[model samples]
Target: MIAKQVNQKAWFMVLPVFLVVAVSAIIPLMTVVNYSVQDTFGNNQFFWVGMDWFRDLLASDRFHDAFLRQISFSAIILAIEIPLGIAIALAMPKKGWGVPVCLISMALPLLIPWNVVGTIWQIFGRVDIGLLGHTLAAMGIDYNYTQDPVAAWITIIIMDVWHWTSLVVLLCYAGLCSIPDAYYQAAKIDGASRISVFRYIQLPKMQRVLLIAVLLRFMDSFMIYTEPFVITGGGPGNSTTFMSIDLVKMAIGQFDLGPAAAMSLIYFLVILLLSWVFFTVMSNIGEESSNGGS
Candidate 1:
């Protein structure tokens, strides 16, 4: 019998990616860590703050308020987008010219820059010159996002939905398309209703992708800044201020480097924790499904 040799050359193919990540990701992370631990007071002067900034942030009411706002926004976005995306995907045809057209149309909003989306909506919602605002105002609706908290929240949420629902739709559509025809054929043979088929077959098949969509939307909505910043400027008494906006104000606007960096790290860790929970739950579901299938 001939001795077998293990091939180790494949690591070379991955070396470039490791190097790129270290340069692009790791180095910046270390810098942020350094900033988080030190206080700077102009003229490049620095003093060790240790965990004082973290303690202050934890005690701050502003931090709590911002976190709550972020959570609410993310929850609202996920609730609206996930079902809407699924419904749109389900309504889409599986084939034909319409498929590409529909995909292209759905993808258009996502392709627009975040700031541009905010600007478009900001202008579009103007009560005087813009079509939507003018029409609503003409109908006697008191719609002013700048002064009204509810209106500001509604505008920001609606803008986010319009811009990001396409991502969920695309992911769900891909999952839907991946299902083999055999499953549908079996459902048809069994005289199953469309609802029954969806609940029993389609939903389970798309669970993994749906989990991903939910997690991504949650994180994105939680950290949302640019759109809301441009549209509402975190105004109407900070009703629309999320964590990222607050962090920006702290770091750039106030030049509180230590506190801002600490907040940023906390924000990042929260996202990481949530993502990990989502992944673990989804993995368990997948495992349960596999075992049940067997």
Candidate 2:
């Protein structure tokens, strides 16, 4: 057989995308890196500070508390959203007009602007005017998010779930759709229960997409800002102040650019590291699944 000539034309096709990404992403990243290492007093004034800001951030109790709160929020969000999404997806019709209707409805929340979501929820949770808050108050519950830390936390968590669970649902639903009917047929032929079919066939097949869902949710939740900020304003004694909010407060509120930049870099790294871990674990799981299939 004659050796086929390798196509060089594909490189030309990809070049524009590379150039666009470099300009939009890499240049801004370099700016952040520069800011992370330097001090700026005012217009055009700068001095090198090395790792001072990093050390200070690491030692600060405020930073530690924010970190812990962020981690906890992310964990809770993942725990609630992933399972709930899966359940909703499973319960949805396998085929019909209902499928598109369900998908479109689910996607509606995601289509809303982030700031708009925050504003809507902020008004929605007001005890006097909001349906939820008014109903809760009428039911004799003390449900003032403005004064109660627990209430604020609960509201924020619930709001996040309402806003983002749709994403998880969509991803899981797509994964479910991609699964071949032959597997389900075989499971049915063997008299497998619903649970057994889900466990042995569905769950395994959806692992890769679920991994993507988990990573996306984790990163988004961890870096969340606008919703909580608008609703709680990091209030109720900073009980709802996540790392992203704190970073914004430092960078803009305090005008501490150097430290803020350092913290931001660290924050970016933490996200990158966690994403890497998720990717590695998913890759291993995929490898094992492939080996087993073979």
Candidate 3:
């Protein structure tokens, strides 16, 4: 057999990306790690603190509350967006002019910037001049997100659903399109019910895409800052103060560098851990499904 040499030129092509990542991500991460273990006083003086900040954060009630709020927000987002996206995708026309119209409409929300989304909703939800707020007031519902915690939470959750559900819809629509026509024909021959067709065929086919959607939604919802910050300012008395928002307050608002750095690292690790668990559980389910069918 003749020996074949591998191409060494690929590494050169990838070097620019590697350098960019190092400059953009790696260096800032290293700086945060350095800050995580140190304390600073005036006159640019510093002292070793070594996990004290992390310990305090772990013991703090505020930190626990922020974490719970973050988890709750992500949970609510996933619950609302996933099934809704799937339903919308299923209802969309598979072919013809309506398909483009539906797709374009779905995509428009995603095209808006996050800050702009928050601003639009903020104005839209005002009790004075905004249409939604004015309509609700006319209906005699006392709604003010600025003063009510429940209202603020509801506003942010709805804003997130409006913004990101299109991503899930698009992913799921692609997944459904990938399913061969033969499967539907088989179901038709078997006189399968619509629910059965969905449960056994569409649902199974969408597992991988659903997994992707779930993970993406979870991470984004967990780390959400810009939209909620602009809309609610984490307010109505810490009602919507998620981990990222709280972390920003600790770092920028309070100038608590050590604690903020520690919290950021912890935040990253929690997201990483949960994503791994989701991927592992879904991959196992997929494998079992494949084996059972075989």
* Model 3: lDDT to the true structure: 0.94
Candidate 1 per-residue lDDT, tens place, 221-247, comes to 888999999999999888988899999
Which pairs clash in the backbone of model 2? Answer: none
State how far residue 114 of model 1 sits from its true place (Å).
Answer: 0.9
Give me the displacement of residue 287 in model 2, in angstroms: 2.1
What TM-score does each of the candidates earn?
0.94, 0.94, 0.94
Q: What does the lDDT read for residue 1 in candidate 3? A: 94
Q: Which one is best on lDDT? A: 3
How many residue pairs clash per model?
0, 0, 0
Writing each residue's lDDT as its tens digit, candidate 3 over 181-236 gives: 99999999999999999999999899999999999999999999999899999998
Worst lDDT window (10 residues) for model 1? 285-294
lDDT of 1: 0.92
| Candidates 1 and 3 compared by TM-score, better number | 1
In order, the Cα lDDT scores of the candidates are 0.92, 0.92, 0.94
Ten contiguous residues with the weakest lDDT in model 3: 38-47
